[model samples]
Target: MIGAAWRRTLNDDRSYHAINLNEFSFTVPIYAYQVEGEGGLSLIWSRPNRD
Candidate 1:
């Protein structure tokens, strides 16, 4: 899971400032590894390990 946040200012009245974030979440790889092979350096990604 990943999150993004930003600060925003309202345009009404006294111009209130507020903190805002994404209402929806995105799924992304959490585990990654680098390997050296015949093709040179490579990157591999996998799911989180529970153990």
Candidate 2:
């Protein structure tokens, strides 16, 4: 699904020039913190790997 979206973006009509993203990988920052909830403080952390 991600690959299909990437292909669509590359072929989008809004883009005038070609876009080539080869051998690329993207990583979002892992945040670890706490949030105050109605039941007091709650834990917040990075999402575990899904695959």
Candidate 3:
């Protein structure tokens, strides 16, 4: 695995979130969303778009 995260629940939406530690030693916020009909969660992490 590239990195690991500590799962947590949100108080507002009751959704899951975490802080991702990448292999490069950078920490980024990641969010977990439930997949439709799959009964699974997908982690999403992205950087701000600069145009």
Candidate 4:
């Protein structure tokens, strides 16, 4: 999900969001709709343990 869920939250057209997930210490940098484009999501950073 991106850009305020594209549904409108708190009646605000624009809002700031951050993604922080800790399992593999995964985190994503701030991204806007302009970057997401049609995909609606951008992978800024990722870590995977294939082993």
Candidate with maximal lDDT: 3
lDDT of each: 0.40, 0.37, 0.48, 0.39
**Whole-model lDDT, candidate 2?**
0.37
> Which of the predicted structures, 1 or 2, would earn the higher lDDT when compared with the native?
1
Relative to the unseen true structure, what is the C-alpha lDDT of residue 9 in candidate 1, on a scale of 0 to 100?
A: 39
- Order of models, best TM-score first: 3, 1, 2, 4
List model 1 lDDT by residue over 1-51, tens digit each: 242323343454322222222223423334444445578766554554545
lDDT of 3 by residue, 1-51 (tens): 454656455665464545444444534433333322355666555653434
Number of the candidate with higher TM-score, 2 or 4: 2
lDDT of 1 at 51: 57
lDDT of 2 by residue, 1-51 (tens): 112112122244532222222223524333344444479765455634636
How many steric overlaps does candidate 3 have?
Answer: 0
Error of 2 at 4 (Å): 38
Q: What TM-score would every model get versus the actual structure?
A: 0.34, 0.29, 0.36, 0.21
TM-score (C-alpha) between model 4 and the true structure: 0.21
Candidates 3 and 4 compared: the better one by lDDT is 3
Top candidate, metric TM-score: 3
Q: Which regions of candidate 2 deviate over 4 angstroms?
A: 1-30, 47-51
Error of 3 at 37 (Å): 9.6
Which pairs clash (backbone N, Cα, C closer than 3 Å) in model 4? none
